[model samples]
Target: MSLYMLPLAIGPWQIALIVVIVLLLFGGKKIPELMRGLGSGIKEFKDASKEEDKDEKAKKE
Candidate 1:
């Protein structure tokens, strides 16, 4: 099979290890703030995409 067909192989151990690394690098307090900012950025991106779609539909109509 081609590499493109292969599923991601990450398991619980890998997830735990990554979480530990992030905690060590950013500490517990900063992680929440980072996550909040990331969430807001994603929300803004979604809103922008919806607005763009509306604009495209308006133009086509």
Candidate 2:
């Protein structure tokens, strides 16, 4: 099984609780702002991963 699927990890209820807590902490007013930042971070991470893949391919050529 994948490490991500290991037992004792969060289930649906825990995930729901976490989301609720985050909403409460950041508030509905600011969740979108936080999400925007998160989206940018994810984009940057994906871009970096792709760049690394390209560099590895170039090195093997």
Please report, as a residue range, the 10-residue window in candidate 2 with the lowest summed lDDT: 1-10
Candidate 2 Cα deviation (angstroms), residue 43: 1.0
Q: What is the lDDT of residue 4 in candidate 1?
A: 72
> lDDT by residue for model 2 over 1-61, one digit each (tens)?
7886787577899999999999888899999998899999999999999999999999999
Off by over 4 Å in 2: 1-8
**Candidate 2 global lDDT:** 0.93
As a whole number from 0 to 100, the lDDT of residue 38 in candidate 2 is 95
* True-structure lDDT of candidate 1: 0.95
**Maximum-TM-score candidate:** 1
Model 2, position 24, has a per-residue lDDT of: 85
Score residue 50 of candidate 1 by CA lDDT.
100
Question: In model 1, how many backbone clashes occur?
Answer: 0
